[model samples]
Target: MNSNWFKLLMKATRVQYGENLKLNGVPVVFNKQGAELLIGDNVTINSSFLSNLVGLYQRTIIVTRTHDSKIAIGNNVGISGATIYARTSITIGENTLIGGNSKIMDNDFHPIEVEARNTDIKEKIAARPIVIGKNCFIGCNSLILKGTILGEGCVVGAGAVVSGVFEDNCVIAGNPAKVIKRL
Candidate 1:
């Protein structure tokens, strides 16, 4: 779809965005009633297969699942086929690069207990806020889970499974990501 139409659709869905929003292909953005989904100015969301060099497996998906949930993407952010699902809150600071096919979530979606998984899922679900600081780079295919807090200029290596708090200017890699190098 064209830029104008997309902007209108976003507005109708209560997704607020700033000027110079660049869309290589249409992204799947859903904001629940009373939720907030904000995209800052000069942001580029690449959804099409050829939009990013990393070869995206799917289009970019941004959703706010709960009424009080929020997803705030800062200015000059570049997102490629990433899936950002917020049950609580997610904040991506300015000048961040979210690589292709990455997933950022503020909730587990389901309870850890098998019994609770099917029943009373909401009560058992664990949700937390994720804060990715400015100038951070999330590598391709990485999984950033709930409660993650990355300080400014952190670099997450490809395929890393990140959780917990990380200091600034570090290079993080591995399945359970750790600081591989301090930059």
Candidate 2:
């Protein structure tokens, strides 16, 4: 199939998308009932797998499992090969850049306790909101977990696993990421 046709088919699947939502490329967006996926204008998504092209296990997957779940992406943002799953809410502000193979999620998917884990995957799920503020840069192979509030202009280094509330204009890196520098 043609690229444009593929994009049009994908666009038909989104719950809500704003002006110029496909400025760069198409993104795979999935929303269940009571779930809302909002995308603002002039968003650039260069996720190869999302476009029905041959990619190396890469795709832009956005899923809101529950009815109350939401995934809101602001204008002028660029995302590549990212996976964003929301059980509550996941908001990415304007002018943010997300590198390839990155993940931003608002739910733990399972409990920490062995018994609870053995019981069910959603038994002890701790879902929270994830907010990535404006002008942020998230490097490749990063993980932005539940309850993470990245302030404006923050930078998350590659291969970092981040959580918690971080102030504006700083660099966060490492596993269980910490502020490495102030920018």
Candidate 3:
């Protein structure tokens, strides 16, 4: 899709974006009423399969699920077919790279307790805020769960499941992400 048209769509959803926003393909962005989705200058989002060499599994999905939720992406960030869903809040700092097929969510989306799953879905949902600091690189297929805070210049390895507070300049990897190296 044309970048101009995409920008119009973003405007229609009340998503505030800065200059030089490049859209390789039209992304799926849904900013709920009374929610905020802010994108900074020089951002590049690749949604088409061939746009990123890493190969996207699907179009990029950016959603603010609740009225008070927010998703803020800083300047010079690159996203490739990732799913960034926020029930509360999510902030990605400047110059960060969210690799292909990655999932960054600030909510569990459903109740963990079996009884609450059907009876009290909204009230029992678990959610927290996610903060990815400046110049961080989240590798392909990574799952950044609720309450995760990554400090500046951190690098997450592909396929890692990250769900904790990681300090600055850490090289993280594995199922439950560990600090493999400090950069």
Candidate 4:
């Protein structure tokens, strides 16, 4: 196949693609640059099989968020149709499987009050960092908001909106997501 198409993909990897980098027929687009996007070895960031981590740019450059950001995906990760719109930093740990159409953000992007949102206040909230631990499985259509951390082995149910820190191996769901059960 054409490995030239993967040069951009290779540059997108964190740790300078480390020892081994694997992308399987994936369509990837970057909104901005001067930031590192780290994807580890044996990780399939495939857009053909499942479209995850594919940035939208309307054939030009689809940006989910307007700020330059850092997105780090660790080893053995499987992301399928996940949208991460970050103005700051987003780190996902090893062996995590992010589901289809899930939107994750590291910043609030806007203030609670309408007036504050009109100015630069939202930018303050948008600069915070987000981290997800090892072996977590986030469900389809889930929205993980800014400043939220999911501990190891967290399973977020479909269509859930999550904020704040959640316990490891717990099943969380619903709006403003809560722990439903522990796995």
Number of clashing residue pairs, candidate 3: 0
RMSD of each: 0.8, 3.2, 0.8, 4.6
Question: Number of clashes in model 4?
Answer: 7
Judge candidate 2 against the unseen true structure and give its global Cα lDDT, from 0 to 1. Answer: 0.83
User: What tens digits encode model 3's per-residue C-alpha lDDT throughout 68-171?
Assistant: 99999999999999999999999999999999999999999889999998697696899999999999999999999999999999999999999999999999
TM-score (all chains, Cα) for each model: 0.98, 0.87, 0.98, 0.75
Per residue, candidate 2 scores C-alpha lDDT tens digits across 53-126 of 32414767788888889999999988887899999999999999888878999998888888888988674888
lDDT of 1 by residue, 82-135 (tens): 999999999999999999999999999989998998686696889999999999
lDDT of 2 at 26: 44
**lDDT scores of the candidates, listed in order:** 0.96, 0.83, 0.96, 0.68
Q: RMSD, model 4, all Cα superposed? A: 4.6
lDDT of 1: 0.96
lDDT of 4 by residue, 1-183 (tens): 344556555455422444355544444446454565655776654444333434322111112244357777788877665566667778889999877667777766666666677775755464567899999998877888888899999999998999988878999999979999998
Q: Give the TM-score of candidate 2.
A: 0.87
Q: Which stretches of candidate 3 lie over 4 Å from their true place?
A: none
Instruction: For model 3, give the 10-residue run with minimal summed lDDT.
Output: 116-125
